[model samples]
Target: MNSPVALFQELVQAGPPADAAVHFDTACVLGGSIAGLLAARVLSDRARRVVIIEPDDLPVDPGPRTGVPQDRQVHTLLPAGHQWLERWVPGITKDAQDRGASLVGPDQALTAVNGVPLAADGEDHHLLAIGRPLLETLIRQHITSIPNVSVLKARASGLQYRDDEVSAVRYVTTTRADGDEQVLQADFVVDAMGRSSRLSHWLGDAGYDVPRLERLEAPINYASARFDRPETTAELKISGVLELFTPDYPSHGVSVAAANAIEGQQWLVMLMGYGDNRPGRTMEEFRSACAQLPEIFAEVTAGAVRGGVVTYHQAESRRRHFSGLSRFPARLVSMGDAVASFNPVYGQGMSSAALHASCLAAYLGSDADLDQAAHAFFDLQQVVVDAAWAISAGGDTARLDAESGAQVPEDIRQQRWAMNQITAATVLDADIARAFNYVTFMLRHPATLADPDLLARAVTVNEAARVTR
Candidate 1:
């Protein structure tokens, strides 16, 4: 087995494998989510036929769809996520731009601490803030265009096994009122139903040991509202802005807020708060919160509010330890939020899903045993899950009260202090900023921050910054 860092590097560096190796005769994906769509794209490369089981009546033109209440919230494509998107769906960024999404380069992106923007390092990394609706629509279009992939408007009910191997899937169509379920024969099956996935229950009901679930209580509430962007945005040299308040000085009880120049010539600004600091849903409350944030938030929210404030809440971050389980069936795997769902404030959902697709591609393209459980794929996926989980949950754990019944290890507490130092030093040093950005963008693992030289520099820079202050 390769080291986690080595595997991560391989996942990001490799593109879709050659289509010469066909692995499965028929594969069924449970949901038509971005994760599922991407998985279908990968399966189309290896499977002769791929069928997506989705319950929603998704429109040809993707405005807002049912079952996705969070579509109205602002979503981000980290630079690493953008790389995977381009690797999977070639020219997708350009397609989004043609359709009105903003393509923000490192120079055009802004990250501020306590209202002070970090200095630009002029790196080659770039990101797309296309918002969830447009991004999903474009990916869905590309996935549907593949000749071997088809989508079935149905809800997955259960699985059928033949001699302990997944042979088919059971689902009920959306138009059916008789409550009749149909079986679709699948040589392979993927569960991408997201956080609400019932794969565990299904497996337990069938006498299979289910993966143990782990959760961290993170009562996060955030609200987003769209507004008309200023025509002079280009002149301002900022296409994306993330204004963050450290724990020491949260602005008006708001921990973080962001403004992204999304498609439709508008800015999607979001305000987030933990536990008791819920953002208001009314327009008046939204504007009040923005006014208390940085100047950019005020300037962007100054425009006429285009829609009502959209709010979303997540009580905890969860992960299912599938690799730890030994009694799993062959020809079956789960990805995306089905395996692990993290805090959305970190913007890792889509990108992590894309990487999970990369893991699927790697597994299918490899010479692994097809008659056994997908432990190899799970190993590769664990690296990605651990990386994302650490970034999102690690921070949330620190913010919660000590009486919340959560225990923090001494080593983890020490590491968090070091990370805080490095983050604070980003505003003062460019080299450190680049390295920090690489980790935050999901381009590099969090372990890189622990390098002795980097930590020494961060300490030095932070001490000097304190003196200046």
Candidate 2:
């Protein structure tokens, strides 16, 4: 008899007694980052008030905000991410395209996998690569457009909790005229503060100890440059996409046209690392990285119409192990980079965030409890993110397996064998390719490849291809 949204509102507003409405009136989001804003947007429906706190002064025009350094960088919403965004924001993808965002077909752009060129058969897979800041600007505007959300320019200095539950969000924020300390009370608190979350320290302050933490370095470095699209190239108005390497070379590059309008019309070239290799920023080094695959990257840039070098750094793959924790707060949740960060080379961050947001919507729609929601969220997120990571890291694992004293142990050989088949099969069979594309796009589960019928098809098809090769 009641709407899903209405039921979710009731659940969020209710007390520990679950069925009783304790009247949760306020919620605060840390960092005003993408994740934070999305969380605020969702919470706004239930809370009497919602505030978005950020350390930097937000601009009136869409530009890079100080908070997210990756803002100026290139970001892509994989199909999985696209579907997830549609669920939460609804029509935002269309808005992005209408507002000058280019939509390219899956194989339309340059993408190389496993040393072989992905045939741009001109169908199915699609990628929406835009500047991070541009995408963030659109999302920020949408959040502001929402009726009950407000933005606050403040850096969350710390957090406060009571009765083993998050009680308040503390911050030291600066305004146009002055700066001051603030403590906003709420029935819920969300740490959407990106990879720099202080939830661990905040928990310690409240006398809670972190049970488990696992952090590893992918040792990735990013160097980007903007170049002029070749005038001779007729696809100027086309969604220009470029790529290098196939499968696990542990490195790749992307050359995407500007999102909307950058004062100057140009395309962006971003080269990045996965296991240990990094994208070089210098014109020479950058060209060298592109040179590895002279068929597309270097050749296209050779005729590039315009832009210059801009290099950056990101090293590390982290997971908070929050799901393994025995106790956690309800109504209080997180998504995006706040949960896990991937090797940026894959451009899976936004999509992973979107998938997580979709989880929130799914859990809210059902009668799942807080614990159930958190667990379900992470479980699903692991698939979305790890699918991309596996492909990215699987390449690394290949190199490791080839060398002596590899970091990955021998316990997962069987798993790796199956993955190898899937990899080989996708290259030969369109059926396998479609299945693989679905996983890469976050459209299907990674385990889908393991299906007996599908795996048999992959094996049969790949075996035939090998004889021809």
Candidate 3:
């Protein structure tokens, strides 16, 4: 099977035929978030009209809104995600860079899994460091600019079905009361309403069985704040991340010196902890939390002007098993956090969403039946979700094995040990570091790190490090 990256490359090289037939007259996206915008962008090519129904009147500028509470948190576009966005929205990276966003090598901001600074290997694997709000705004601007795409400020109330097929979307304008609902007929309806989606409830109401849900409860919490980049630390262009979420240690700290897309030199620092070790909202507590992780966090935060601190709590990572459902409504699909939401600390949500959008595009471009597209899209989306889940929730599960009273299988245990050696080897070997970076960025599969040759080198490096210690 082709990787998502390869599929995207093929799509880019073989642009849609000029005389391609339209499959649908109209498509409705239930949310105006990143996932919805990307989906609408793709739908514009195959559908005569695409409507993005959102509750909030999106801002014209780069600023936080109430719709996405996590917009203020630290965010970076992984290399794979950056490529997808650039392909979907031409000149998007340049547009963001022109407005103070920076594209920096991943090594500049990364620390090895063992708390050692990663070596600068001079390889060019650039990742985007811009505010999440700015990224969303730019994407929205691009999608809305397409001739067939438009935005409507309204809240999706439910799905209206004709016989057994999804036929229309019921919604109410933001200014209107509940009784004054309106319906928009659509050939297709997509739910990109993030983790708060009501699609499952709406499905149950429509007499369809709700999909089974799989959840991993890590019970993690985060506290994030922006700070003026200290003049003393201006020379350091990279960010600092100290992850200590092993079975022994459950706290993590990250200080990202991202170029604010709107203006000014600022660093977004976020501290995360699992269960009872949650980070505090106060400045002093934040400092104390950082002091517990690594010295770099305290050093960078010292003498820095602070911004408002925001806290968020997440009980679990969730996945709805839509692909496993015996029956699903025709002409309806879900994407982004609505389908699967991972632990944000792993930074896989946005990239996974981008990959899902690519899957949607691939399905839309096919000659398959529209009524059966939901199953095919969900099957493809499950692959993307599985990879992300293994990376984020899998790590959390491994770290909390003892606390959760879960037993790791023997084969899985060996794999984890090999992965640990690879992580340790990254501090000494640039090649290993590159492989680790690629896996972390979702550009490559984790299995790539466990190749026989690589594993041999990692074991050797691990033994040498142990002897020296």
Q: Which candidate number would show the highest lDDT if scored against the true structure? A: 1
Model 2 TM-score is: 0.82
Clashing pairs in 1: none
Higher-scoring candidate on TM-score, 1 or 3 = 1
Model 3, residue 88: displacement in angstroms?
A: 1.2
Count of clashes in candidate 3: 0
RMSD of each: 1.6, 6.0, 3.1
Give per-model TM-scores: 0.97, 0.82, 0.90
Tens digits of per-residue lDDT, candidate 1, 233-337, equal 546678888888976775877888988888878889999988888776788898988887777777888777787898899899999988867888899999999
The sequence of per-residue lDDT tens digits that candidate 2 reaches over residues 353-439 is 655555554444445554322555455444444555665565555644655455555657666777778767765766777777666
Best-matching candidate per TM-score: 1
Q: Model 2 Cα displacement at 203 (Å)?
A: 0.6
Candidate 1: Cα lDDT at 76: 91
Number of the candidate with higher lDDT, 1 or 2? 1
Consecutive 10-residue window with the lowest summed lDDT within model 3: 254-263
Which ranges in model 3 have alpha carbons more than 4 Å from their true place? 1-20, 119-122, 230-232, 239-263, 303-306
- All models: lDDT? 0.87, 0.61, 0.76
